[model samples]
Target chain A: MTRSFVLAGALTLALAATAACGGGEEPAAADGRGPITLTDTQSHEEASRKIIDAWNAAHPDEKVTLDIQPKDADSQRQRLINNAQTKSDAMDVIMLDAVWTAEFAANRWVDELPADMVKADELLAPTLETAKYRGKLYAMPWLTGTGLLYYRKDLVEKPPTTWAEMKETCEEVLPKQEGMSCYAGLLDKYEGLTVSFAEAVQSAGGTVVDDSGTPTLETDAAKAGLNFLVDGLKAGLIPEEGITFKEDEVKNALQSGKVLFARSWASLYGTANASDSPVAGKVDVAPIPGLNGPGSGVLGGANLAISAFSKNKATARDFLAFFTSREQTKTWATINSTPVAHTVLYDDPDLVAKYPYLPSLKEGIIKAKARPVAVKYGDVTAAIQNAVYPALTGETTPDQALSGLQQQLAGLLKQ
Target chain B: MRRGARWFAALMISPTLLVLALVVIYPLLSAARESMYVRGEGLDADGFVIEGERFVGLANYAGLVGERFVNAFANTTVFTLATVALETVLGVAMALVMHGVLRGRGLVRASILIPWAVPTAISGLMWRWVFQADGVANAIIGEKILWTTEGVQAKLAVIIADTWKTAPFVGLLVLAGLQIIPTMVYEAAKVDGASAWQTFWRITLPLVKPALVVAVLFRILDALAMFDLPFVMIGRGKFSVETLSALVWDEATQLRYGPAAAYGIVLVAYIAAIVFVFVRLLGADLLADARSRKGQA
Candidate 1:
C-alpha cells in the first residue's frame, strides 16, 4: 500500500520535478526551517560546531548544528532505534559504526541520499560500498580508521614489517625497555580481538567468508594469520595480562609507554600524541604487518544516516552533507585526530602541521577495508571474536577453536 | 454499600493488571509473534507474520538448538544455578551470623550490604580492575591471574562479581527471615536441652525456611536472566561469558530480530517455568510449615 503511494508520488515528481515545492498559507516555509541540525555521538562535537560555525560565517544561510553524545555507544544506538520505531525523529542525523550502515540500509530504517547530496563514485571507493544496500546509499561515509602499528621511534630504530619481525623486535627491545611488551595483542575477550584478528587475516589476503557469507576458518591461509596471534600468546611477546585488556587497557599501555608496539585504530593518535601521554614525544604509527602479501587492515569508521522514521529528512540530509564536506572533515581530523575519509583532506596544510603523522597515516586510510557489510555482520563478528579470543589466550588450539567458530557463524548465517 | 466497596476494591486492582498488560504482556505477545517470522531484506518482517511477517513455524527454535546456542545455554544454566546456589548459601550463613549471637552485628550487617548497593556495572568493572595483573586480587593471589582470559577464569570472575553485587540482597532477605523467628522458640529448644546446632535445626531453621526458599528462588530466577556482570567482564563477542541475555541483545543489535525474538521468547519461558516450578515444588512444604506456625502465633 505504501509502495503504490510512493510510486504515484514518484510519477508526479517526475512530471513536475522542479515545481514539486508548493507554498501556501498553511505550509511550505522556505530556507529549510533555518538550516539543519545533525546530531553526532563523536567526541569532537565542539570542534565540529566551531568548524560548522566558520562555514556558516562564510555561508550563514547553511546553518548546521551538531549534537555529540560521546559517552555511551549503546545509549546512542538505543535512542536512535527507539526514536525511529516511534517515528519521533529525535535526531536529524545519526553517527553510526561503518558496519551498521549496511544493516540500517537493509532494514530501510534510513533514507537513501538525495540525488545531489553526494556522488556515489566520488565517495571513498571501498568505504562507500559499506553504506549501500542493493546498490542504493543510505549513509554517507565520514571519518574512517584501520589497525595501525604504533611503535616507539626513540627506542626502536626500525619497526617490524611482519608478524615474525614484530616478535623478534619485541624480544630484542622489550627486555631493555622496563615497561614495554613486544606486542599489545588484545588478548582481552572483547570485540577488539576480532578487529585485530581481521586485520591480520586481511593483511594476508584471506577471506573470512565467501561471497555467500559462509565462514571457512579451516582454510590454510586463515590459520597462517590465526597462528600469529596464538604464537604471540605462547611466546609471551604479548602479555598474558593483555587477556584482561580492553581498548582503554591497550590505549593506557601505549600512552604509558609500556608496550613497544600496539595494534589499535588510528583514532588512538589523538590520545597517544596528546600532552597527557607519557610517550607522546616518542610514538609513531604505521600499517599492520603482512607475511609475503600486501598489507591490509579492517576498517574502523562511522557514517551519518537520516533515520527513515525521522520526521525531518531535509535537515538530516543537510547535516549529513555538511558534516561530510571536505572543509569540516579537515577541521575534525585536525582538532580531534579522527582520520577524514575524504582523500582530499590530506592536502590541508594547517591540519598537516597539527598532525605531522597525517601524511604517514594516509597509507592506512588509503588501504582501509571494511568487514563483511551484512545485517548479520555483527553476529559474524561476535562469533569470530568468541572463536579467536580463546586461541589468543592459549585456551585452545587455533585449529580446534576456530573450527568451531567457523562452523558456528556459517550455521548462523545459513539459519 | 459493602458490595459497592468490594467493586471499588476490584477497580483499584485493575491498575496493576493494566500495567502488566502494557509492560509484560504486550511485549511478550509481540516477541512471540516476531519469533515465528523470518527477516529477509528490507521491511519483510515488520508486524505479525499473519499481518506482514511470514511465519517459519519452529525453524527459529530448531536453529538455536545447535552447538553455539547449546553451549551458551548450558553455560548460562550452569553459571546461574551455581552462582545462585553459592550466593544463597553464603548469604543465609552471613545473615544468620548477623542475627545470631554475634558481636558487631550492626557493623557486619552494614558492611555486608555495601557490595549489593554498588551498581552492577560499576561493581563488575571494579572486579575487572581487581582481577587485573597489577590490581588488588592479583596482588592478593601473588600471581597475575588472567581473569578475563580463559573460559573457566572468566566464568569465575563473573560469579565473583555477581555474588558481590547480589549476595547482600539475599542476605538482607534471610536476615529479615531470621528476625521473624520468636525468641520463645529458642528458649523452649534450650529448655529441651538442645545444643546450638539442635536449636538452629529444630527452631530457627523451620521458622526461616519460607523466606530462605523465597530468597533463593528469587535469586535463582534473577540469575537466570543475568547479563551485566558477564557483559562487562567478558563482553558479548566472547562466548566465554555469553549468557542468554547477552546473546539476545547481540542478535537484536545485529538486526537479527527473528533469532533475538526467538531466543528472548525461549528465555522468558525458561525463566518463568524455572521460577514457577521452584516456588511450587520447593516452597510448598516450607509454605505449609510457615502457615501452621503462623496459625500457632
Candidate 2:
C-alpha cells in the first residue's frame, strides 16, 4: 500500500510537471500582445461570439483572439478568484456580473479601462453609481437590466400597473387552474432576492441603501414593500414554492403558462417571446407594479473589465471600446435580442419590431440602479436577501426582518 | 536480501513522498506565505501593499478572533460533531443489514449501495427537490416543508443531503471490517452461552473499533470542509448555516483576497487542530498496530 502510494504520488508529480510546462499557460496573445480568456457559456455564447467575429473583422491586424470557455456563473467567479490568487496571465479581459465590479475593484483584481473609451456618467445613470468605489471607474457597463412584469395579455384584459390589481388577478386565476400560480420574482435567497426586493422597494418608494450608500431599508416604506411580498405568500397568490425559486423557476413559470404574471429581467423577455414559449405572443411586459408610486425595478447586468495581470492591456481596451461603442452595442442588441446599452438600438425599427418594448427596456437601461455601492455591498445585499426571503415566506415578520437588515447593514458598515 | 528489500521499499516510498511534496506541501507552503499579507487594489493584477503584504505575523490571526470567526468556528464544530455522530450510528446499522446474517447477501449489498453509488451532486439535487415545498417528500407527508425558510430546517436539509451521500461510504468501510471479524469468535461466544447483546458488545464492537474510528475521522474531516451540499441546499442566511468553506468561497468570489487569505489560514489552523486532536485520541499507529498484533498473535 505504501509503495503504491509512493508510485501514485510520483506519477501525479510527473503529470503536474508536464501539465505546467506542456500546455498549462498557452500563449494567449492574438496580436503579439497577450491572450484574453473569457467565460461566455450557454445563453451568452452567441453574444460573445458575435463580438469576437466583429472585433476580428474590424481589428484585422490587432487580431484579438478571445478564448470563450463554458462555465456557470459561480464557477466563472471561482475561476476569477483562482486566477487572481495564482496570478495567472492566461486571461486578460473578463466579463463580470455588474455587482461584482465594486467587489473586484475594492480587492484590486481588475483595472479601469482607458478613460477615453467611455464617458463614466454618459453610459448609464444608475450604473455610474455602481461603477465607482471610493471614486474610481473599475468597470465599463456592458448590458443593463430591470425587472418587467411579464403577463399573459390574451388571458388578462390589461397589464397590471398596480400591486392590488395583480394580486386580485392572481387570487382569481390561481385556484381556478392547476399548477397555475402568479410567479413573482424568485423568493430564494440570491441576487434574485435583490431583483424582487427592488421591485417592491421602488414601487413603495423605498431604497435599501441611500445615495451616499448608507443603509436605509429599515424605514417604513421598505417595511411596507416587504409586507406586500409576505402578504402575497400568505394569501397563496404567489405559491409557497417561490421561497426556494431561482431565476430559472420564474422563467419556467411564465414559459409554461402556469403563472399569470411574473416580475423578471428584460433578459428573460427573449425566452418568453421565443416561438417555443407556451404563452409566446400571449405575453407582454411592463415595469413592476406599483401602489404609492410609479413602477420601478432592480437593475442587474454584466460589465466588461481588463484584468490587471494581462500583458495585452492595449488590445483589450480597443476591444472593450468596440464592444460597448454606439455601432457595436446597437448591432449586439439587434442580433442577440437582449437590451442594448447604446440608445441607438431603441429606435432601430428592426429591434423595436422584434421587441416592441425595446423603448421601455432602453429607458430602464438609462435608469438602471444598483442596490448599494458600499464596499460591503455584497454583505449588505446578502442581508437584504436573508431578511426579505423569510418575510416573503411568512417565516419572519416584515418589520422584524427589515429591522434585522438595518442592524446587519449598520454593523457591516461600521466594520 | 533484507537490505536489498529495504532499499526497494524506500525507493518505492520516495516517489509517494515526492508527489505529496509537490501537490500538498507546495500548496500548503504557498498558502502560508500568502496568509501573511495585506494587499490593495487588484489581487490578481498589480496589487500593492496598502497596510502590510509581508510578515504581518499574528495580525491576520488576531482579525479572526472576532464574532464571524467565532461563529464560523462554532458552526463547523457543531456540523462536524453532529454529522459524524449520525453517520456512524446509521452506517453501522446499515452495514449490519447489508452484510446480512442470512441468505441473499449479494442482492442486499447491491441494493443498499444505490444511495451511496449515486453521485453526490446528483444526490444533492435529488434531496433538494424532495425537500422543496411541494416536492416528493412534501407530497407524501402532505405538508410543505419550509426547508430554506427556517434555520433548523435548513441545517436538517444539509445534514440529510450529506448523510444520503456519505453514510453508505461509512457503511461499506464498517462492513469490510465486520467481514474481517473471525466468525469463530462469535461461534465460540455463542457456544459459551453468551447472549446476543453480550456477543455484540464483546466481539463485534472491539474488533471493529479501528475501522469505526477511521470512518468517523474521515467523515469528521470531510464534514468540516463541506461547501457544495449546503451551498446548493440553501443560501447561508444572516443567521448563517454558512460553514468556513462557504465563508472562504463568499469572501474569495466577492474579491476580498487579503481577508480571504487570512480566512484560509484560520481554516487551515482549525483543520490542523482537528487532525491533531483526532490522531491523538485515535492514535496514529492504531490500524498498523492492530494488524501487526494480529499477525504476531
Candidate 3:
C-alpha cells in the first residue's frame, strides 16, 4: 500500500508538470519604456547595428539591443515564428520578409501600426501595399527588391525584351562562347523557386493566385510562362546545372563569367561591378524579359513590425519610425547599396550617379506584384514548389503541375 | 529489513525518475495530446486568425496518407538502410586498416577521426561546395552531374557525405573491440596451423560481434532520425532527399502543429519498432555475454 502511494504521487507530479507545459496565459501588457531587443537577419547587421548604436547613444534609458538571426530567409522566418508561439518578450521588433507580412498580421503576432505612423505617401505604392493586411497597416516597409536581367554587354549588344528574343539571342551567342551558358535563375526547390515561378506566370499575363486568394494556375498564360522555363531546359538554353542555382549561385555564375544572361536581384548590380569581379566592366542591367515584352518582377524585401508580446511597444514603434525616416533610409541605401522604399531617392541626382541601375530598378519595382497573400503562406509556397519543380525537372507536364497545384491550394485555402 | 532496503533503493532512484518524468515523459505526453487537435483556421471579422485548437481525434494521422508524407517516409527508410549498410562495410575496412598500421598509428587514427569531429552542419556545407555544378567532384569525373538537384544523384551525394562523416565513429568502436581480444587466442590458432584468414573468420569475427552489434545499433537509430546533412546539403522540399524529420520540421515551421506532432509520433513508433526487431535478432547475444560476465564475477 505504501509503494502504491509513492507511485501515485509520482504520477500526479508528472501530470502537473505536463499541465504547466501547456500554452502560456496571455501576458499583461508592459509600459512602453525600457531597453528592448530587435530581432533581424544578419544580411542587414552592419546597417542595423550602426542605426541602433546611434539610437542607443541618444536614448540612454531606452537603449535598443539587436538580436541577429541566420542569413537564410527560411531560418529567420522559423525563428521569428518560434519566438511568437512561445509568447516570449524576447523579440520587441522584427524584420519580416514582405511575403510574411500577411501571415504574421493574420496570426496577430504583430500589432497593427497607426495609419500615420510614417509618411506612407513617400513610400512606393507597390511596396506600401506589402505592409498592409486587410486594409490595416501592420508593418513599415524598410527595404525593397525586384529581379533584373544581368547581361554581358560585350557578348550581346542589345538585351532581349521578349522571351522569343531571349531564346534567339541564346541560340546566336552560346555557340560562339565555348564555356558560357545562355541564362540562369533560381531554379532550386525552395522559396527562390517560388519567386522565379511567380515572375514567369506574371510575365506571361497570368496570376498564380487571384485577389480573393484563389488559385489561378489553370490558364494558357500560366502554361506559356512555365513552357518558357521547361522548353529552355529541354533545348539546352538553360544549362542542366541551372537547376541547382539559388540567389548566391546565380550571382556567382554571372560574376565568374559562366553565364551570358542571368536573372537576379537588383543588389547583384553593385556586387557584379565591384573591383574584383571578373565581369565588372562588361555587365549591364535590363528589365526581366517577358512573353511579349519586358516582364514584371515579384516584389522582394523586408519590413519592420512591432511584436505583439513586446513590453516596450511605444519604444518599438518610435524606433521603427526612426529607422525608416528619410535620413536613416538614405544612410542605409548609400552604405549597404540597398534599394530603399523612399520614392525620392530613386531620382536624386547624386544618388543616381552612384547607382545608375536605380532607375531601371525603380521601374521594375513599380511594375512588381506582391506574392499571394494568405495566412497559410508557408503551405501555399510549398505547394507551388512541389508542383512547379517536377515540371521543371521533366517529371510532369505544365498542365499536370498547374492542375495539381490548383487542387492542393483549393484544399488548403478552404479551411 | 528487506522492506526497509526496498524503500531505500526507491528513495535513491526517485530523483532521476523525477527528472526523466519532467523532460522525456512530459514531452511525449504533450506531443500526443497536441496530435489529437487541430489549430483553428481562417480569419475573423478583424482579419486576425481565429484562436484556440479544436479536438479532431485521429484526423491528423489520417491526413498522413498524402503523397508528401509517403515520399518522406520512403526516403527516411531508404536513407537509413543504404547508409547503415555502406557504413558497416566501410567502417570495418577502416577499423582493419587502423588496427594494422604500426607506423604513424597515432597520425592515422587522428586523421581518420577528423571527419567525425567536424560538426554535421559544417561538413554539410563543405561537401555542398565540393558537389557544386563546377566543383571538384565534377572536375574529377569530367561529367557535369548536378548533385544538388532533385534526382538519384542528390540521394547519392547525401549518402556519400553521411558515410564519410560517420564511418569513423564505427571504426573507433570496432578498434576498441579489436584491442580487447587476447593475444592468446591468435597464438592458440597459430599453434593449430590456422591460416590468417582462417583465424580471422573463426576467432576475430566471433570476438568482435558484441561491439559491432552495439555500433550498428547506434548507427541505425541515428540514421533513422537523419536531418541536418540532407537539409543543409540538398535543401528542403526536394522530393528526392526529404526525410521524415524534414517533413515534421516543414510542417511545424508552417504552423501546422497538429500534423507535425503526428509525424513526430509516427517517427517515434517507427524507430521503436525497428529497434525492437534489431534487439530481438542481435541484442540477445549482448545480454548473454553480460550474463556470462556476471556469472564469472
Best-performing candidate as measured by lDDT: 3
Q: Score chain B of each candidate by TM-score.
A: 0.86, 0.84, 0.96
Q: What do the candidate models score in CA lDDT, each in turn?
A: 0.72, 0.71, 0.89
Q: Which digits, one per residue and each the tens of the lDDT, describe model 2 over residues A333-356?
A: 766765645555567787788778
Candidate 3 has a DockQ of 0.55
Candidate 3 per-residue lDDT over residues A25-100, each given as its tens digit: 7866874788999898877789888889889999999999999999778888888988988899999999999999
List all candidate RMSDs to the true structure: 9.0, 5.8, 2.3
| Real interface contacts reproduced by model 1, as a fraction | 0.30
TM-score of each: 0.83, 0.81, 0.96
Kindly report the docking quality category of candidate 1: incorrect
Sorted by lDDT (best first), the order is: 3, 1, 2
A182-271 in candidate 1: lDDT tens per residue? 778565655677777777776666767666667657777688878877777677777767766777888888877768888777667778
Top TM-score hit: 3
Which candidate do you rate higher for DockQ, 1 or 3? 3
Which segments of candidate 1 are over 4 A away from where they belong?
A1-37, A51-75, A114-116, A119-129, A132-136, A175-180, A207-221, A255-258, A273-276, A393-415, B1-12, B41-52, B100-106, B187-193, B285-297
Clashing pairs in 2: A6-B16, A28-A35, A29-A34, A29-A35, A107-B41, A108-B41, A108-B42, A108-B43, A109-B42, B38-B52
Name every residue pair that clashes in candidate 3: none
